[model samples]
Target: MASWLARHGIQPTVVERASALRLGGNGVDVRGDAVTVVERMGLLPRVRELATDVRGMQFVDATGRAVARIHTQDPASPEIMRGDLVALLRAATDVDVLLGDSIRALEQDDDGVHVTFEHSPARRFDPVVGADGMHSNVRRIAFGPEERFITFKDHYFAFADTDAALGEDRWVTMFNTPGKMAGIYRSGNHAQAKAYFMFRSAPLDYDHRDVAEHKRLVSEAFAGEAGWRTRQLLDSALTDPGFYFDALGQVRMNSWSDGRVVLLGDAAWCASPASGAGAELALVGAYRLAGELAAANGDHRVVFPRYDAAHRPLVNDKQQIGPNVRLKVPKTDGGRCVRDVVARLPLMKAMSAVERRAQARNARPLPDFTRAA
Candidate 1:
């Protein structure tokens, strides 16, 4: 997104709450139209170079026996650690990024948007875009309280990177019990493995940014699981410095803009991580939002609505495909068994192919902004 804007002579100012660009997280898949977006940004080769080379994912039983497998080769999508992608995007653009600072408040007028940062002096931009993620400060100041637009899916998940010796290489090994899941994701990079745990629960009351509280919640939820290599993963995750926890939720807004304030990525309409489209949506949406702004010659009143209209159908379709909690991290032992059995069937392969094709068909290519030159 920054590259697109810079190429068009617009210098963007990026503010991040974190002290620096985050350099760790679970891997993210870049597939279909998203691959096109990266290619257009001229980052595809670099992205691929940093991609995670997990050969497949295996569903395991309580006894740690592999019950089924889904090979990455069957449906090829470039998977890179989220951090690597963020770094790539950051390196590609010359935007002024403010780290360890965030928007405290946003006030807009007919002429521009005024923003006050928590650690920086007040400033104004002709437009203010909230690309800050699901819990967006910019969105709240511009669009009202988050509870009105966020929907919880009654589940919580946590992940952290740990020493790679905890799991095997070239595969993501997952195990399930009734209403809970525990797993280890092994990347080709032997430096680390990711510990993941998820359970069905009503949204817990806690501070969103409190790491200790987040660890406590995850520890409490997965404390007594008795099988499938849960103990070690739990121990490592609880102590890991990079542990992360959040509810499985969706952000749905009636519209994504007000005055000169607009939103992109998870801030505007998160289809949820379960959709496997969050990164794709972020990349594609950012591109289109910037393109629309340029196309409208800086008139956000004309551009923001167009951005929303152009992106909504894709968002709606992916979200309506339903909560994929069960698919990625099945709850019941019986459900896991069923999933394993189905995955081994010929129909599963066919269905996966069909689904990929459908997603590609549904995606409209982002406009070529260079053409508008």
Candidate 2:
């Protein structure tokens, strides 16, 4: 997104609520239309260079017996770490990024939008776009309350770095119980490993911003687990500063824009984390949004609706189906068995091929902006 804007002579001021760039998150997939966007931005080579070499996934029983395997080299898919992609995007732009600052309020009119920041001074832009993630303050100010948009999918997940000696490099080993799952991901360098845990749960009443409370909840839930590497990972994860926890939820909104105020990325439509499309969607969506605005000569009245129309179909297609929580974290032992069995079937291969074809068919080629001059 920053790349597209800078190429078009639109200078953007980036405000990040964090004190510095975040270096957390699991690997993310970049396929279909998103791959095209990255190539267009001239970051394809860089992205490939930094790609995470995750080999495959291995499902195991409590006794540590391997049950099923899914190679990461599956022809229909490709993946990279979230941090690598963010680094590439950040390096592509010359925008002035303001860290430790957040927008407190937004007021927009037909002419422009005025924004007040939590620490920085007030500023106005010709347009305001909220590219913030699921818990977007921009969405709240422009649209209604969050309850109207967030749909919880009855699960909670946590992940963090661990110190245990996981056997191999570049493979994710998973162990499943009735309603919970624990896994260890070994990265290419082997300098770091990640511990992941998830379980079925109804929506719980808690403060979303409370990290300490989140850690407490995760520790309490997995306190009784034994063997198969669960206790070691859990103990290490709780003490790690990079630990993250959140409810598996999706964001659904009827419209993505209002006047000069618009939304891009997860702020508008998040198909949920399990869909593995958040980073791809954000990167691709930002590219298209900026392209549309540039093509329309920065006249958002002409650009916003078109951008929404062009992108909403993809979002609808991906999210209209139920959340993918069941596929990522199976709820029951029977469910896990069923998932493993189905994964090895020829029908699964066919379904993956068909889905890729559908995505390709729905993709709209980005315009050649080099000739815009």
TM-score of each: 0.95, 0.94
Identify the runs in model 2 with alpha carbons over 4 angstroms from their true place: 74-78, 320-323
Q: For candidate 1, write residues 1-373 as lDDT tens digits.
A: 6677777778889898889789888888887667888888889888878778888778887787788887764234688889889889888888898999989988888888789999999999999988878888888888888898889988888999766786778898888887888888898854778998888997779998898999998888887887878988888888887899998888998888888888888898887767878887888888888888778888887898888888887888778644257766667767877778877777666776787778668866667866652
Best by TM-score: 1
User: What's model 2's overall lDDT?
Assistant: 0.79
Tens-digit lDDT track of model 2 for 151-247: 9977888898887385357788888777788898876743677899988887888887788998998887787989588988898888888788988
Query: Candidate 1 has which clashing residue pairs, if any?
Result: none
Question: Residue 67, candidate 2: how far off, in angstroms?
Answer: 0.5
Local distance difference test, per candidate?
0.82, 0.79
CA lDDT of 225 in candidate 2?
Answer: 86
Tell me the number of clashing residue pairs for each predicted model.
0, 0
